[model samples]
Target: MKTPAIAGLILASFALFSPACSQAGINLENTRVVLAAPSKEASLVIKNSATEDLMFQAWIESADKSEDVPFAITPVLKRLAGEQQQVLRILYSGKGLPTDKESLYWLNVREVPQKSREENTLQIAVQQRLKLFYRPAGLPGKVTEAPQQLKWRLLAKDGKPYLEVTNPSAFHLSFAAITLRMGSKGFTAPIDMVAPAATTQVEMAELPNGVQANSLKVELEVIGDFGGILKYDGAISG
Candidate 1:
């Protein structure tokens, strides 16, 4: 992945991470920072899901898009918690990007310390999901058509059977019901939507009973708001 000169500059100023929970309560929910932008730089808005006072640390981590890449975590944000919503921002510097008029980056957020049992579960689940927001670090005023599909293939450590999928649209796709089917077995996509113009390869090793195969048939069926459906299918050999 050779990053363009612009990407080089974008990578330098970029700081990507997930959001923190804002309130302090038994069901303290996470405060999320959503991404949006016109330039190569990306920004997120962190919102609290709880109704009470709260505080916690925050930080970022690189998602395991592939088994070949080692896990990398960003620096931690200390004493960052509140009841109201907050904003966390990141800028991208020069970085390698695909020359095919496409670019990608990983964005994640880890909780400082879940305040309660419920909060702990939320944080843990988010961590396990390995949430990453993909971005298209294109140059200014460049327009590209959104992809009609998103695809992925997963391989087990034993190299027996794995999973593969192709999403039919570039719009935000829900991962809640997205599952990996192997004969009678099934596993869900760890997180939600694969950012537009990006291909997300979710690591299945961390999923329940997910690492015991070499190769297998994989498919993804996603539901849309208009009662429409998106599906992807393919075979992967471990």
Candidate 2:
């Protein structure tokens, strides 16, 4: 019989030759829209599957009815690991809304790779419809009174994402143009606003990587402010 040291070496060699194990993966869960008690900012949840650990990143893009739209990342590129999940949030403000109300959007989630290569990278993309409308809240010349609440909704239109804004104030809050700013990428869209109670939507642009999808970051800009200070929603990429 072989000595203990020789036997140990043989066992170690055999273990090294063992095949890699393929574990099951997790699915996205609990994706729903949430609105604050008296605010326009909304929060959405992204749950992961219960199988293997995962890494992911988030991004937003513009969608057009008959053309390829543009999109950008909020934080450039990011990485996520398995068994762990992250929450991607976006703030909705009415800006350059299309009068057509037929625009769409695609929210993308991509998986990061343990090793970097063309074949090993995987991506998952979710397409949503966008509907955003806004109107002023509070009466004009009422300085002492609280501003009326601006009603906003990130709607799930036929299993898609959309937004609408409602203004309730006497004064007109101009929401003329919308600019989608992601990382160093920018896209401008022209639109008109209604006084006191206008409803409209802006279509989303296509992602950078076409159908395959990748990790990315995103931010939304309406007229002047950056969606009332809520910025950036993202995920991991390979």
User: Which has the greatest lDDT?
Assistant: 1
Candidate 2 residue lDDT tens string, 52-134: 44454555444333233332323223443445555555544444433322223444444432332233232332222222222
**How much is 26 displaced in model 1, in angstroms?**
11
lDDT of 1 by residue, 8-106 (tens): 111011224433333322222222221233343444445545554444333343343332211122223433344465554554443443323322334
Name the regions of candidate 1 deviating beyond 4 angstroms.
Answer: 1-38, 49-53, 65-82, 99-106, 114-130, 137-238
Candidate lDDT values, in order: 0.40, 0.35
The per-candidate count of clashes, in order, stands at 43, 45
Residue 132 alpha-carbon offset, candidate 2, angstroms: 10
**Which one is best on TM-score?**
1
